[model samples]
Target: MVARPDLTAWRPAVAGVAEVLHAHFTDHVYPMHAHGTWTLLIVDDGMVRYDLDRHEHGALSDLVTLLPPHVPHNGCPVTPRGFRKRVLYLDADVLGEEHIGRAVDGPALDDPLLRRRIHQLHTVLAERGEDLEAESRLSLICERLLGHLGRRVPPPPSRPDRSGLARRLRDLLDERVLEGLTLQEAAGLLHAHPTHLVRAFSREFGIAPHQYLTACRVDRARRLLLEGQPAHAVAAGTGFCDQSHLARNFKRIVGAGPGWYARAVREPASRS
Candidate 1:
């Protein structure tokens, strides 16, 4: 039987924004629950057993995976050697508008570049290497992912009109996609009750609170693919746990595979 775990603050921004960089190295027990957005799990050490959508998989270094929203899932460390990781919770709406990224169960890429990006994010978050310097490093890391992971637009004029909390939420998500933000976190950041914030955000955003968040991640992923990044890089750089997860989300909104879409763009002759 699946064990249901108790609730902790459940803030993805703090937990998901940067790599968790676990020092505990202990098994993590989580109960099955549905989410509003996709989650990307990046394993840095050892392996993990993930029960996602009622399916299980064991993952180790450089492995990436995506978990869709409203899909029940659970995670358990494979051993006491345990593991350390960076989890990104993707925002789906963004996927549709921008990137074709997905949120899966593990790391998005085994590529050295992807690993370097994660390490850099982790390092900046942990060491705070320098004030402006660290922030610059963090921004560059995200920009590289965007270059590798996001597609190009017509320019700022063509950008969508995302404002207020929705805009802030989306901006925050460009780097930290798969993180789940609690109602409290939302309220604290937005200065409203969890319920009020949800309603207001949904009302103003033209999508549910959670759905908006999912979009943010998806958009970034889309942009990356459009810009000529590979599937694995898109998965890791944009915060989809892995390529499979990116495929799932990409199919949902674009109605086709990212590879196929990218091919179409690259080979204009095929348009005939």
Candidate 2:
């Protein structure tokens, strides 16, 4: 599935957390596409049928459907009422600052605590509904999410090729993110096809190339902002079109606006 790219967008403040739309989507379905973060789907009402990788899971309320990043899959409604759900894009290892590519997948769906933590994060997102502190609230949720998943979320993968590819991608983007490199470019660097790259990248890193790229830009921008760089400068340096462009995509992926992230990260430093 192609990402929605043509519209003007803004990041809702999310502390260190980000989320997509939160609504009751009925009969709506997604084709195979990739996302930037781990998605925790809770069936609030009716049922949905989805295939995660090869495992076909029948969706039900109170059951959290976890999609580890980058693995391609699709879903449809088992009931006409469809489903109510939300997606959080970032979690509070403060957005994987310390070698995120190091985060490797060990086992999928064996951890129940990760599910519960994501549910809590979802609750905060669902309840906040775009308030000023909504982001900090979400960050708290993310902190909890990571803390809970720390042990449960599979330890980072150890293969050199896997981590090496991730690091290389980040470095390449860092040189010039504005070139708008496609997944094909990444796959070529790894000597893999786009589809295979999607599967392999997701399986190893928990997100696809596109999502991984976005996260790298966002994190770099975050560090720059903490240095008191102007939003526009940081955005440009990080490979977004401009400040507004960066802010929109940043919020879309990180779940918090640029201004909010900078201020929140700065206040504490100023205090100390």
C-alpha TM-scores of all predictions: 0.39, 0.39
On residues 1-272, what C-alpha lDDT tens digit does candidate 2 reach at each position? 42232222234445434455555656577677756666556655677776665667775665545455666668877876666655555543443533232232321333455556556545544432223124323433444345534523333435666566666655664564555565445657766433344444566677655566667778888889989998989987887757776887678877899988887773554643
Q: At residue 81, give the lDDT of candidate 2.
A: 60
Q: Tens digit of lDDT per residue, candidate 1, span 164-269?
A: 6555644543434555454445456755433344444455667755455445656877888888988888877755557876776677777888788777675345
- Give the Cα lDDT of each candidate: 0.52, 0.57
Which structure among the candidates has the greatest lDDT? 2
RMSD of each: 19.0, 14.5
Question: Which 10-residue window of candidate 1 scores lowest in summed lDDT?
Answer: 127-136
